[model samples]
Target: MTRPLPYFEVSQRLSIKEKVGQLFMPAAFINDSEEEVLRLEKLISEHHIGSICFFHSRASAATNFEGKKEVIHNKNSFGRLKELIKRYRAAAKYPLLIAIDAEWGLAMRIENTPQYPYAITLGAMQNQAELVFEVGKQIGLDCRKAGIHWNLSPVVDINLNPENPVIGYRSFGDDKKQVIEYARAYIEGMYSMDVLNSIKHFPGHGDTAVDSHLGLPTIEKSEPELLQNELYPFTELMKKNIDSVMVGHLAVPALSHGKAESASVSKAIITDFLREKLGWSGLIISDALNMHAVSKKFDRKGTVECAAFEAGNDVLCFADHVEEGIRNILEKGKTAQIEKSFERLWKLKERALSSELVDGHLQQDEELMQNLAKESLSLLKGTFSELEEFRNNGFEYLQIGKQNGLFSELLSNRTNNGPNTLLGIFPKQVKPKDNFGLTDTELQLIGQTLKEKNTVLYLFGNPFVLNLIDWQQAKTVVVAYQDFRSFQENAANHFMGKIEAKGKLPVTLKS
Candidate 1:
């Protein structure tokens, strides 16, 4: 039997074309259709694409939203994923690295998997390092079981601004040292199990009020200020040899030569500051290229592709036209630059292949999962006596959540069987419109119900939603960091005196 060649040796031998191809990781949708599978196969075989980022909605089993019985389970998700990997490996010149934005777990991006607390909740825990390590271990285990090699998570950005539309619950915390400690543990856990982790939104996305997904965000801090706060986690993580850093499209005038360019395409920020000043040699991947922050400025595919490469990014993730982007760089006779990018890209892939993939059997660690759930719940500002009183006094309990998942179900299970009457509320807010309106009737009903209820448990999907409600009337209020089922179950257990709430509020909530 022959021993497998090392990743570095394999990467060094890859052609320029293959190396360039490795830089383009586009979003792919896989269904049960044969044509979709074939198209995916062609992308791997002919284009030499390096990775695929899976979205939960894209891979979700068809579900009957209106009337039809659409796919609503993990069987399809797992089966399709297996088939995709099988096809990807069979057609590729080398093993294609598979990645997903499984920040919390597969449940965050896929259905049926256990939903852990959001990063902010973990950050709030008294045992942040342990919490993050558990999170990383569970996520890594799930990703490896599903044949995923990369996890775009452990959002290391410090939540400096409460008004930040993004990076709120996703962030570890506002304190630099706390963020570093928690993030380091999380990265180590992921790497320990062979799941490559990517720290995101460099130099930081935590201070901006605007969401970069909608448009460019400006980080007005001075270089020294950024180094102290925003860049702290990245610097610390890099010291530990983190697998990757995702560059967000943040417009930092202080970091850029001129005042207007985004950081994703800023040579000074990426190459000079991040690469040289920070001494990070790991992969530098751009945030989704299709986001308005990058796409809106550069309309042409070729121009965007050239600019990203020139700016020193190794991977052009989520490009609109991945093939065109690769061709433009090659056709423009920038093969040398492409080769450099490929060297970094292939080196990272080689590292991934050489690393120990996550063990699937750990997914069955029910006791460990339960303990994690218990530890991650937050008790914000209330006592067991208050909760017990509320439960005994016939107070109606209402659970406000975003979607139907484990979190909602756990809340339902906990509050439903109790003497408290539980009502689950789901709110929808479309982005860019800024129209977060509730009908007069709905508002009246909520107010009336709260007045009648003994306690109100608001399991916020995101902390931003807290502003939309009036929590003054409730006897007891709990903020479960996210809508993950584990969070909900944990929060419920805390409220019922089954577990102690050791988590602090990572973000402020309006009373």
Candidate 2:
């Protein structure tokens, strides 16, 4: 490893622009236009932006955007990213820390990469802590291969609300003990692989009904309540040498003395509660600055950036205006805080960069992912003999839920095109009127098919998808937590008795 200047010495050596550069880590996309490319280059070369948090414009799981932007898809996403990142590194004045929300691996953002099961699926595994560790290690290897320095994940938030808009399957589960153990194992795995991990949405975003990306949600819990439940994982994780903590964009009124804005840019919450009370010396990064939670409240864009800087956040993520934010930081005149943030950032940059980048060495651990998924697949109402018989006899498949994507992709291996039209089951978003989600009518079609032919109903979504529906009428029913291609494939294997169902329900299914 290359030895660099000590923190204090380096702090003394740096100019104003370099120090300012250390405090911003704005967002980056996979593919870009010529104009946007020039904009990024200017941000790096002139304003000296420090890092870039990468998100997918093409490989997005959610179809949230529409119109002309909807048709834009970046080709060969993984290869494109490698070339794009190389150019980004060359543009930076400092070694810009490349970060991504690889929660379940790069497949979460990038189209073609190794994908592990979600945290909830991993949490459901019995005595599979080592498997979870490998998941992290493999993700770290992926990051190094992709020229990424940081993995903005290992979401430690305890899932207190099944209705939580964003954090449902992403979190481990509702059990705090399970969440803590799994999070530690994951962190250790990533750390062992020499990639940095950040425990996210500090003080928790797991219990909210609203999505911060849309608007600010209030977590109306008392401080004591937060400490016992929501804050447990964060407190436990902090005892270890944690790399960074991403504060949530929540209106944690109790923690901030009734502040209207999210905790990400609250002085009392970040400085006094987290830094002083908890004694966290690692880097403190705000959640995405462009998020509506923070952006909607501030009239001018620069104000949010300035407040986040003053709130003691070491790095402001997803800031829309890098130049204006930097000017605001300078105008705010928090010289001491800026230097302190710069030194901490340098420490993280060195630790992350020192790890050797392994090229094409790590492939997605599909077998491991399958094993865990099989372990997590539950037999809600079925017999092993029946599954084996159906596999041998060959049952026709009928698909429900999302047509072109979720359902079509899942049963690709199964003979959905067979005679004696088989029933395929899909889920509807719990609420019907919600924008952009799969329809629930597929379940009804499966029900209709069950009335005639011998059918096996497989549910691949939130357990609440069966909230009010009577699924007991169908003889063989399997409820796999979420509907990704891997989950669907594993569900098929379980249905065929090739893989026995070892998974118990991670959450209680009232239906």
Candidate 3:
């Protein structure tokens, strides 16, 4: 009888194709179409890809907040996910681990599910442990239902720079100790439910003003500075044995040999600092390789994949051309490196599978959504008397951030009974005109609203857009932080003295 191969020996002997395949974790778009599902299945089976991340647009059962149409039912989503898993397992050399970036909850990534407050809101929370536990439990339940085993969340990066474009509301806060405290709770919560948690943007992506999705950001801080502030949370969390760390494509000239290279592919940062000095035995995954920060600079030279592996990243995520990238690495004779990375990858998968302890009471429920929404909403800065002032003043026009939802309708009903003079401002985007730029008509309407209304209640959804708005002339400015209906309503109610504004500003708003 033939003896089964030893796990480590088999891992060491994996073909270049199999070794390369272990590195990739691609995004799978899930629409109602059978073709999309078939394509996803093919990718999983043929490539033996390790994990798949889901996005909101890919979900089949999403619906507008007030809309009755369900985009996907929980049972259907669960069933389809299991079917896909079975298909991949049948064709794969090993069991594939599935994951999602469900930071706040599954609703953060998927629609028709309960939506929780942003992480910044949680940062403002005084009860870090309870909130973190709740967030983990909720995320764990939803992910388990969908057969997802990993959550790329609890962005442990310290939000030191207020102007940080990407890590804004995603980070816990700028305080290192607070970030560690909250992150530990979040990790404990997820791990308790058998879901692996990934603490991201290693050595901190918090200080940069630039978004990594747009271009590579360089940090000039020395190792000591990074250790004092940026690396504090990672060190604290490593003591707790967090499952993973995601390296961002951030350039630190003081830390790395070159200027343009990001930490994601920097050996000094990932291998030396994170693995050796910090002694993080957990898996290390790269932030999306396809992100412009790395791709735009290194794709043509075929340096990113090899560099990422050399930097000690076990999982190469979101590579635009997975097979081609793998082929290039193999041709470059980096098969041994690939096998080493695969061993780490397989070990993580095994750990995730073994962590499956359950809590029956922690199952997903509709009532929990309302509770989460209520708890997650931040009061920021304001007074209960402000609500009385708004109600008594009776403003004819209200300016709201340009978003489609129940908040807009509620503001309309409270102010002028229906479709009142509401001016909407767009959010910031990659292209200047695409985000935050108002049309001539929108600009004119906003000007008119400010001029006509004695009580101009401005509902600022995104705090970043506060500078763009003409806050100087407004009678009352309320920063809702987000445009979620619950938040908007809470802001309006707070202004009307129906509820007290208890939330402090999570991030600075320059007006």
Leading candidate by TM-score: 2
Instruction: Tell me the tens digit of each residue's lDDT in model 2 across 1-511.
Output: 2334566777777688678877888777786666777778788877777788887863231323322445356558888788878888788766778899998899878777777777877877767778889888888889888888899989999887756777877888888888988898998888988888899989799888888777788988899999999999999999995899999898888989887768988998999899999899999999888877788778886888888888889999888878888888888747888888888898988788876777884476768766677777777776988666665665566666655354445445766444333344555542322421444454455556766667677767665555445667666777776666667777766665667778765655453
TM-score of each: 0.84, 0.88, 0.80
Stretches of candidate 3 off by over 4 Å are 1-17, 32-43, 56-83, 299-303, 328-340, 355-382, 386-390, 397-399, 402-460, 470-476
Q: Rank the candidates by lDDT, best first.
A: 2, 1, 3
Write down the lDDT that model 2 would get. Answer: 0.77
Residues 1-511, candidate 3: write the lDDT tens digits: 1122445776756666876777788775443457766776777777868777765443331212224545544444434545664555555555677778888777665545555666676666565467667777777877776667888877988877756777877876766777888788878878777888889888789898887877888888887898898878888787775778999879987667555588898888788877887788778999888677777767464467766777778887766576666666777645566777777777777777664434232245445434433444454333456545655555454343355655556656556533223333434331122234555565566666667644334444444555444655565555555555555566555555565444445555563
- Give the CA lDDT, 0 to 100, for residue 495 in model 3: 51
The most accurate candidate by lDDT is 2
Tens digits of per-residue lDDT for model 1 on 1-511?
Answer: 1122465676568777777788888775544367766776787788888787776443341121224435434446666665676677677776677888888777666655656666776777665577578778877878887778888888999887767776777887777788888888888888777888899989899888877776788988788898888987888778775778999988998888756788898889899988988888878998877777777888776677667877888888776676777787777636776766777766666667775544343244556556655665665545778777765555344443345555444444444355555444544531212423445566567677667755455544454555555656665556654544555567656655677776666665544
CA lDDT of each prediction against the hidden true structure? 0.70, 0.77, 0.65
Screening candidate 2 with a backbone cut-off below 3 angstroms (N, C-alpha, C), the clashing residue pairs are: 398-423, 398-424, 399-424, 400-426, 401-426
What CA RMSD would you report for each candidate? Answer: 4.7, 3.8, 5.9
In angstroms, the error of model 1 at 322 is 2.9
